[model samples]
Target: MDVNGFQVLPSQVESVRLIFKRHPDIAVEFRAKNQHLRNACMDFLLSLIETMCQSLEDLSNEDLVEADIALTYLKDAGFKVDWLEKKLDIVKDKKEKEQSSLARLQEMEDSLLKLKQHCSDLDALVEKEHEELSDTRTPMSFDDVV
Candidate 1:
């Protein structure tokens, strides 16, 4: 128990009790309302997480020193910091995805704009050719149509 930094009641009896050896004052006890072991176990785990979060909440939000203190406390208690690492990894992945999506969207927009400019240029060329052909032709009153 000392090495693991936590201990559970040796056997299942009647009620649930989660006790911290270091902080004996911070403990929770409750009975199973529905007599379902799974629910009882889940509730007990949730309470533990809540207790941990509350302890973290007591740290100052503006100070890195407080954060270091919390980290030291967790490390001393043999808690794994893998959750923090996983969170940073998730944030990095999401940012990368967002940046790539933005780049693709910008590329598509540029291609569309270039296509539009090319179409406009082609339309002007067709108009200019029509005007030149009209000017070069000899004009006669109704004779051209006949």
Candidate 2:
């Protein structure tokens, strides 16, 4: 079947859909926060396919040339897709690293707070002991049977 400027075999659309479904998370990441771009790309591709299908009845030499042009356009779009995918992968990795670092920092903060509290408690205990020892060490009575 003709799709856009490229030929769509029976398996082509299905294959594309399957690939996207298989990597749904990646697809979502690539389309992240930009429904407009995603929608535009999908619509453009679909329309190109529809035009190709409609032109199939008039498959003359000129039509063939047009199809070649369309195919080139589609190929360029594929390159863009590849670039977007790579960028998404990098973004995901960066986010994961940031999250990991944040978690470590939070853990360190909690540990530091606990250690500070423990030190404060120890200091209070030591001060109490010193006071107790001072109380027990009564000065020798000056008037005691000298």
Candidate 3:
């Protein structure tokens, strides 16, 4: 879904979900923007990587060097190259509950159909019994009919 012009592909979302499932300990926060400040930092770093200190650029040499070391440490600690979690507004538990509710509705419908059929059968039987009773009644003499 496109939220604020950020198109979230279903496959990408599923991949992120699978990654989270695999690494349950990892916690993710969905924010309107990148809270870690990596996006801007990465852009600076990418420019530096391509230019190799030839361009003075935005970041100073010392800051760039420090950032490189920090990134190395982060990578060593297994915290690098992770996906950002966005607020997709999906709830698995809610979906499951809806499915169960639909199943219950289907069962109720089946029961109602059965009840209607049974009532129909009872009415037919009553009608037949009344007809038989009428047939079994014997005619009486005109004086005795009263």
Candidate 4:
């Protein structure tokens, strides 16, 4: 089977099927590993679209006329350009949100580290004061009271 531009051999597909049959939870594992695979596929599709757009921009008038005719046919076949655009926009928004969440997590980690250091410093100061107090001793005699 051809997935995007990559060919999936029948043997490989069979192997995956066997694994899934043996362990249904493999679906979750596969999904975890497929996150990057999905991202790569999306990136490939985006770049292909960008290259196509650039070529369209540089097309001759005759080619533009032909492209328009082809586009109309594609639209008639239920491939709307606006729908593709909206899908891309959704992916872009998801990427932005992921990045923003990562940045906030990093900020929280930094703050936690600083707070930890402050706690350590306070502990050390308290320990030093305890040691100094222990070192200083005073002896009292009955003569002093008299």
Candidate 5:
């Protein structure tokens, strides 16, 4: 997909070519051995990682399948995936916290609006009652007072 203008939605071959251009390890590895097969392998690993990542820096849980695949592959490759898994957990926590905060904020705003409408309605009722009472109120004369 296109994350931060870094489009990785192209063919695996193109992705491998780009990766090779940027990182020499995959290129050398692929070239040093079963070039055609290693080319696909490197592309697959990178694709899994690209799906797991968000804009190449932040971790995202939006694509857990991708993360799982990448992690499983790396584990099979004898690489430790604990650190990456922990990073994913952190990302998931952050996302949950943000969602909760937004929900709370929305509730507060709705409550405030309701209160304001109630106050306005009360004010209008008071004004109408005052107008009605004034119309029926009798003026006292000086003679009646004496």
Candidate 6:
């Protein structure tokens, strides 16, 4: 079957399913590891966003002291901004790696489809040869041929 322009071989699907079934515990272990990384990145970004929002609110408040404090808060916000920018760069790199993996998987799927087509062609050729061979058999009377 085709999935998003990639042909999914029956053998590949079976192998993936077998791997998942045989390594359920390991699967969750890896997933937990990834979730931890993702959560940390998200938390960092959220904290940065919250800080920016609070700074904006403070700057807009009627109190002159709060507006003055917002200036100092803006300076403190710079570190979080830089950290978030670096984290975003890491995310971009991860996305690029994922795209490369998908492309490789698609190439392998295309190769498998070509292999299946060749096998099908070979099977048809063999069937045709068998039919032709059967057609060439000479008819014989039992006594006359003997």
Scored by Cα lDDT, where does model 3 land? Answer: 0.47
Measured with C-alpha atoms, the lDDT of residue 67 in candidate 4 is: 42
Query: Candidate 1: misplaced stretches above 4 Å?
Result: 1-81, 136-138, 141-146
Residue pairs in candidate 2 whose N, alpha carbon or C atoms collide under 3 angstroms: 4-48, 4-49
Q: What C-alpha lDDT values do all the predictions have?
A: 0.47, 0.54, 0.47, 0.50, 0.59, 0.47
User: Which is better, 2 or 3, measured by TM-score?
Assistant: 2
Query: Candidate 3: where is the Cα deviation over 4 Å?
Result: 1-90, 138-146
Tens digits of per-residue lDDT for model 1, 35-110:
3543434344434344334432242333334434444444343344445334334544555666689799999999
Check candidate 3 and list the clashing pairs. Answer: none
Candidate 4 Cα misplacement greater than 4 A, ranges: 1-78, 137-146
| Candidate number with greatest TM-score | 5
Per-residue lDDT of model 3, residues 23-138, tens digit only: 54332222225533433333332333333333333334464455456445434434432322110112223344566897999999999999999999999999999998987895
Which parts of model 6 have CA positions greater than 4 angstroms off? 1-44, 47-77, 81-86, 137-146
* Model 1 vs truth, CA RMSD: 12.5
Q: Per-residue CA lDDT of candidate 2, range 1-146, in tens?
A: 43322244565667446535554432342322355544455555455444444432343445445545654554454423443334334544555666689799999999999999999999999999999999889676768647
Candidate 5: where are CA atoms >4 Å away? 1-33, 52-62, 133-146
Candidate 6 global CA lDDT score = 0.47
Which predicted model would earn the best lDDT?
5
For all candidates, the clash counts are 0, 2, 0, 0, 0, 0
**What would the TM-scores of all predictions be?**
0.39, 0.44, 0.37, 0.41, 0.50, 0.40
RMSDs, each prediction?
A: 12.5, 18.0, 19.3, 16.2, 7.7, 23.2
Q: How many backbone clashes does candidate 6 have?
A: 0
